[model samples]
Target: MRLSGGNGDERSAGAAQGRTEAPAAAIAVTDLVKAYGPVRAVDGISFSVPRGAIVGLLGGNGAGKTTTIAMIMGLTLPTTGTARVLGSDMARERHRALHRINFQSPYVEMPLRLTIRQNLTVFGQLYGVRPLRERIDELAASLDLTALLDRPSGKLSAGQKTRVALAKALINAPDVLLLDEPTASLDPDTADWVRTRLEVYRRERGAAILLASHNMPEVERLCDDVIMMRAGRIVDRGAPADLISRYGRDNMEDVFLDVARGRGQGAVT
Candidate 1:
């Protein structure tokens, strides 16, 4: 099954020129703030993912990465500011953009009693995916979910459920993909395989991906750019290699620690 919609490839091929002309955004956040009482989970954070880009949302626990993603999904209302998906304001009208955006997280569960195929069918229909059954079959094969398709979602092993969740997320061929711990719980080999598949999918569709994960190597490999959050605010932003050098670290994990530990404070770009 084809993932790339027509014209997306052309735009990606001329990405620089496209930016000069009229840059397309897959996700855009401007001074977005989400406060729970006096505590700000996401405080005045701003960033944008250009179409066809893969950006990492890097942070430690309680660093506000998840909260920001929730705001983008319109699952949590922000205290102030705006988040737009494909030019649609998710705050004001999430419905207009929900069909073209999808989220996958290991922590999120589908209906426990539903079979993998059943869950995919429901989401495909919700997204108004055409030839839905065929789409499901294609995704099952691509994600190696064929054998587990008929099994109840809750009965599957963590690794198996992860694949099913990925399949469900891609059922609609979303233009923007938000992934949280996408390869969590998989064995090393399986985790690598999953990363390769995500890489291919992003390239083929020229889609934008917002990856939230603790795997430093994974972030280094998959992200074109990274945003590091600390204490509910953006502390650093740059390409992974640039950040590594800027922080005088050998890898992203060390850099992540530096920012999370206050060493990288006021390093925002």
Candidate 2:
């Protein structure tokens, strides 16, 4: 079921040698800004993710969550400010910095014609994975993709597709994982499974993950810290439970709703 094509692994492995961990901060941002004409997409944002931690980026639509992620990934150049990944400045050393990081989002897609295994092979090669077959097999088993290995990516159900997408992201054994709605459209059981796997991956690799999600429970479960945003600005940042206790709310959802509506104060601390 493997798609025969490309020599990405050599490049990936070479890149890995050059890849360094982000020091104490897996990701660092300071006074970040991005603009689309008059609209300020990200307004003076700053945050840091520690190694081996799961941090959640939470906000309603247009709150600058995606914009911030894009800047971190070096996909969209910032209008101003600094971003660093794996301790390298994202703006100045993106090529060198990008190799250590990988991302997954439901909105992104693998080639529709490619089988699950084929897609994994392609990405594994891209990551310069040594022993690519073993890497793919490991990921497939961890992601529960063994049964769907031969299925065309385009033909799979939402849950199955998510699993495949996750496999693609982890194929390289990246140091920093960026996930945007990793469990979107998944049933509860599937979502829970994905969360457990992510937890294990973080612990095993000491990799940092920055997750952007709308599922409050998902964020609460998977993230050790939560950053809440509104109108492209971070309104609050704290542990999920801390925020809940601070606001006297039952859970993370209530805190999210209050921030989105601007009915509550920003930053509990």
lDDT of each: 0.83, 0.81
Report model 2's TM-score to 2 decimal places. 0.89
Estimate, for each residue in 68-104, the C-alpha lDDT of model 2 and write its tens digit: 9989988888898877898788877888866679999
In candidate 2, stretches whose alpha carbon ends up further than 4 angstroms from where it belongs are 1-23
Error of model 1, residue 244, in angstroms: 0.8
**Can you give the TM-score per candidate against the true fold?**
0.91, 0.89
**Could you tell me which 10 consecutive residues in candidate 1 have the lowest summed lDDT?**
1-10
Clashes of each: 0, 4
Task: Indicate the residue-level lDDT of 262 in model 2.
Answer: 83
Highest TM-score: which candidate? 1
